[model samples]
Target: MRQTSYFHTVIIGAGAAGMMCAARTGQGGKSVALLDHAVKIGEKIRISGGGRCNFTNRNLNGHDGSPYYVSQQPRFVRYALSRYTAQDFMHLLDKYGIAYHEKHKGQMFCDDSAQAVVEMLQNECRLGSVTWYTGCTVESLTALPIAPAGYEQARFGINTDQGLFYCRNLVIATGGLAVPAVGASPFGYEVAKQFGHHIIPPEAALVPLRFEKWAEQGFDTLSGIALPVRISTGSGKQAVVFDEDLLFRHKGLSGPAVLQISSYWQPGRHIMVNLVPDTDLAEVLCRDKVGKKIQLKTALKQLCPVLPERLIDFWLGREPFQAVAGQKWADIPNALLQQLGQSLNHWTVLPTGSDGHKKAEVTRGGVDVKEINPKTMQSKQCEGLYFIGEVMDVTGWLGGYNFQWAWASAVCAAEALRADEHI
Candidate 1:
């Protein structure tokens, strides 16, 4: 092997966390190298939010913890998020004169393009004089001996296609397996395993839900239809609900509501979708059925004015509605009307599977949170070893919560590395 060149910190992955950590660590007067296997850097950010990049959210609830973010140890992220809030990143954006606007639910997106956000992060690294190693794959990683008795921790020797490099601190910000086309890999999880860290089995989050039954039921014909809904998955404490737009796709369901619940949804479990959450269909139908001469289908339109006409027709053609077909609103039995209302309000279905990593906006599970320091993001078992961003078990809601976690965790780890003199 060639002689190993040394640095203060070597971060594997040139994505959000790695780049941000490199900038912070290097700016703090430590030598930093940010490396990635992809030829292009920040492809994830480049394609996020339809190219606008929802960089961060204003609703992080940073004073406590981000309520939208999830982890096995839910409170583990509190410290990092509190230390570096979404407002902190907004200030950074202001410094660069990057114009952004808030969309629904506090999702902030760039007015221009996601490329600008990537460039801004790149410029931040430039200011810190951080080195870049794109298009290079790390062949192997080895834990070196502690530097005599004076050093605080042992260093890491990383073998790469380009050459051998060593660092006092090794940060795995390699992200998760989502968007594999952009060169995502299991390298980070493998590194965690090499050092005795447990990896939580990863699943696709923030992706479309597919169902074979729905496709055969002609629900696929409702593609392009979207309406606000209240969606819930799981039961008891594990249950999660989101009030957002639900979209009908050719295969199954996609949209904010489905994406939000997808993280908590397990295989063989059913999801509850309320087509008309804001209105009590039972109450409306019961009150109006007493004297109305209109048909049941017409009354349904009045009850759910936002629902598409085709979807209303489809629902009217099924089950109880089919039995009461051609009947006037007043002629239909009150019991059947109640049943129809209940069905509309509590529609439940099983998802065969998700769109998987290729279509997943984020990976739900990763390096187990229990194995990392909540404050410093350092491995509990390995000194000078850190995991950040999606590589860790932390997953945020569909909005900008994930990006906020990336920023907060990167800053936390960077600060920890800077405090270590040997690192």
Candidate 2:
């Protein structure tokens, strides 16, 4: 006979979401267990933002009208997000006296270390009396018939290295398959599939895009170069853009702008980058061409002052550009100048692949949102089974949007679990 322990709720993946859910559900005067395979809790949070942790964004719902999130069911996130806004999290931080300061674009980071966040959350979980099981392997989970007696309809039986566990509600908050070194895994999707849920086929999101050998050469000399740029993917309603700082890497492009666009980018699709987004390249070139005998390189320096010198050299030696090289600014034809201006504003490139989950900040897709109740984050096909955080199809922008989703979605599930206890 297997020794068994019982809880009103059991949450797997004691990540940001799972821990938040445990705190809420347990604080509701219910017994909760938060389990994880790793020895440490909140490893992701510990390593985020270079340890300072971009906990949340202040511009979540600002008048700027910038889209801050992405999903197959884009509207699905509105419910939870509306209910628990970024301000709410800030209030929590304030309550704990955890000082934080906003960085660029409304991103908030701890004044001290990311560990402060982990400790704050841990204190919250402690308030709820949430039992924690770390460094434990869960062998399997099986749905059993309704409890015969004394059990609170404990429908799911979980087998783990620690012991047998049973709970009426099971929450899967295992997150997505990004940054595997920090313990990211596909276990959440596997669990969703084990039920009757349909997976959305996850891919690397907010990851660095890689180029082929040929394209890599163009940027290799430009590695470590960083500049503000505008990058976009898709077209029309499907189009998404990010005007943020971009960085050149040995592999390819990696930065806030490229990562933001990479979420919307699909394989075989070309990404358009505006190298001189804030500048009028056409006007600059025309100004340089007006009765000026300046050489191509000389004119380019004035036009692309912010761009790296090596990158400017690489572009000058390339196609269309090669045609104008060695010619004086005055000798370049108007049509050719216009072409060069267009290239500067709309440089296109095809990414062979991304840095994969190893380098991804978050997984792009997961459990399809259509199969989940956005308001409750519970599975439509299966009752008492909830999914939250990055495990869902919802993927936010590179900033603190993902962290906000983790908190909001977890709260949604926890509230629902609390309500189910009364039903």
Candidate 3:
């Protein structure tokens, strides 16, 4: 018979949320056990934000962070986010003397290596006296009999490859299926299902949009070109937009604008792009045609100076523009020039698909937030079972919002578990 160890809490997945929860719970004097299938933890943290790791965003302060998040219950994030703000996480970082700076739009990244952030979390776990269980696969999980009367007893029996462990509280922080290379899995969703909870169908988010005939559209030649543009998708109350840099890839569209809009994009829906967001291309073209005898291409260059020459060449070489390419600006009709302006101002395209989970920064959906308690991050049906971080349906916009969610939700769960100890 295998010897069973008992802990107050057994949290799975030692990534951002699990580690934070363990640290907080252990510091609260609860015995905690942190487990993960990966031998080397925090691989996702190490590679995020080009290795510097955008830990948290300053924008979450003074405002409701739920607006920046996507979920069936977008407002579900309010309680935890309000309880544990970004400032709280920054205070923790300050305690460790981790130097970080805001890169863009209040996105904060470590000044040195992302490894420093990982080390700081590890140290926090140590301070909490949390037990580590790396490279450990859970074989089975069974609910034990509830304690009688006023007796405190282990509520969960988790059998793993290492050994059997019992805990009063079980937290599923296994995260979502985003980057499978970093050990992303659907285990959390599975656990949620087993305990009678609903899961929001997960999809690849914050990934580049891929077109069906990208090369045929002449986008292949413009692979490395990037520019500032306004991108939007959806409409009315559901509409979402982003004013950010757009990058052209051989396969499809990427960069901040595409990634942000991709979160709200559906298969059959169209995305509108303003190529010349800074100026009205049609008005400018018609204005330039008044006196200039210059060729259409030269007039376009002078009108929209911000556009790259390669993109202009590609744009002119394709479609209705091809008929008027060689024609002088003064020779082209105002109707055709207006048509060209509309095309540039409202360039709508349908994306065939996305780059998928392999390239996605985070998974869009997970265990349904409606089935979890917002205040405690605990399951509505199962007592002492908690879900936190990206494992839940709540997903934030690109930047540091997701990390803030992880920190907020983890702290919320920790506080709840600590309160349980006093009960």
Candidate 4:
């Protein structure tokens, strides 16, 4: 913990991945140092899932990697993915006697409070030989030369207000610039760039969609309305789709489906919604022939339970639905039926923008995976330089997949460092 010219491993973040990596490396008999600039560790996790902390996903177990992850070479995540999977993470929690519950969709969250998870992790690190440094803002990294033995031997030349501390190995676990309040900084990406790691464009993910100007009035009324729907994008390029609940916010749309699909979405594209999935609309119309005399508004309300009754009256009423609704029972206009069915089935809205990094649940892109060794979480381009956590482009779904990546990557790097001797 003293100001040293050098140490074995230098992990530069105190979030989930950094903590996991530090613990693993330290447990391997290597002197590992963890540094963070935040006042509190795991601030993001503390406030996650409405303060319960959606920790990890139970469905994933030792897979080669996941399609959900986006990286320059996504295939590289295999080693970490297998070494420390969702099952392994859950085991750790169980060992700690932490009470958690699976909140639909394999998301494990604390039953009591997010604070419990943070305490458990901090306890784990304490049990190890990890040197903890908090409230230390990393100014820059000056990597020292590596010895012939492959283990880091040079001073990291770390700069902070606390003092100058050095480490043989450097880890960029500084995370991404998502929620700056939790110390989300571009420092990670900047450090990677300094060390010559290719970085992908970064953006906000798992945030609410902003509404377009024209529909603001309609969307305003639907703020609290939420329904089970399949949200998707275009085809050819993989479309984002979720068979989950959708909330119509005053700003725009949100909820599980939007959050899930937001990762795959690109700006300026319409976010498509399947109001009634796996169902035929023509059949619905034919079945409703008996109620043909009913007003157009009443018919539409009957078809889509998600649509507000008031909206139904306004949109599908005599004048509004005239373009889609048939005239009478005998003459159920073919074109009108098809149009109404298609519109209801394939509803879409353009997102003016996202909630941005301020409210984003996670960052989308990061250090390009091609430059790092997926097996070891070490820099393939810059020896002794490693990246973990949101700093890597490998993002997960809205669930706890991201946290799992952090744990897995940390273990991978820790084991690799332990096996190698310091230069």
Model 3: lDDT to the true structure? 0.90
State the lDDT of candidate 1 residue by residue for 1-423, as single tens digits. 564566789999989998899999999999898989999999999999999999998887577764677778788889999899989999999999999999988999999999988998999999888988899989999897655243334478889997888788999999998999998999999999999989889888999999978867989989999999999988888788899999999999999999999988989999999999988888788887877888888888888998889889889888868977678899988788888888889999999999999999999889999989989999999988999999999999988989999999999999998999674
Worst lDDT window (10 residues) for model 1? Answer: 145-154
- In model 1, what is the error at residue 94, expressed in angstroms? 0.5
lDDT of every model, 2 decimals: 0.89, 0.86, 0.90, 0.77
Report clash pairs, candidate 2: none
Q: Write the per-residue lDDT of candidate 4 for residues 88-132, one digit (tens) a residue.
A: 887888998888898897888888788877887787777677888
What are the clash counts of all predictions, listed in order?
A: 0, 0, 0, 0
Judging by lDDT against the true structure, name the best candidate.
3
Model 1, residue 21: distance off in Å is 0.3
Greater-TM-score candidate between 3 and 4: 3
Q: Model 4, residue 143: what's the lDDT?
A: 70
Expressed as tens digits, the lDDT of each residue in 1-423 for candidate 2 is 766889889999999999999999988888999999989889999999889999888877523213577777788888888777788898999999999999988898999999988998899999999999999789999777777366667888899999988888899999999988878888998888899788888999998898888443566778888989999988998787889999988779898888888898999999999999987787678766878788888888877888777877888888777878778999988777887888889989898899899988899889998999988998897878899899999898877999989998999888888887442
Locate the minimum summed-lDDT window of 10 residues in model 4. 146-155
lDDT of 4 at 139: 66
- lDDT winner between 3 and 4, please give it: 3
Each candidate's TM vs. the true structure?
0.96, 0.95, 0.97, 0.91
RMSD of 4: 3.1
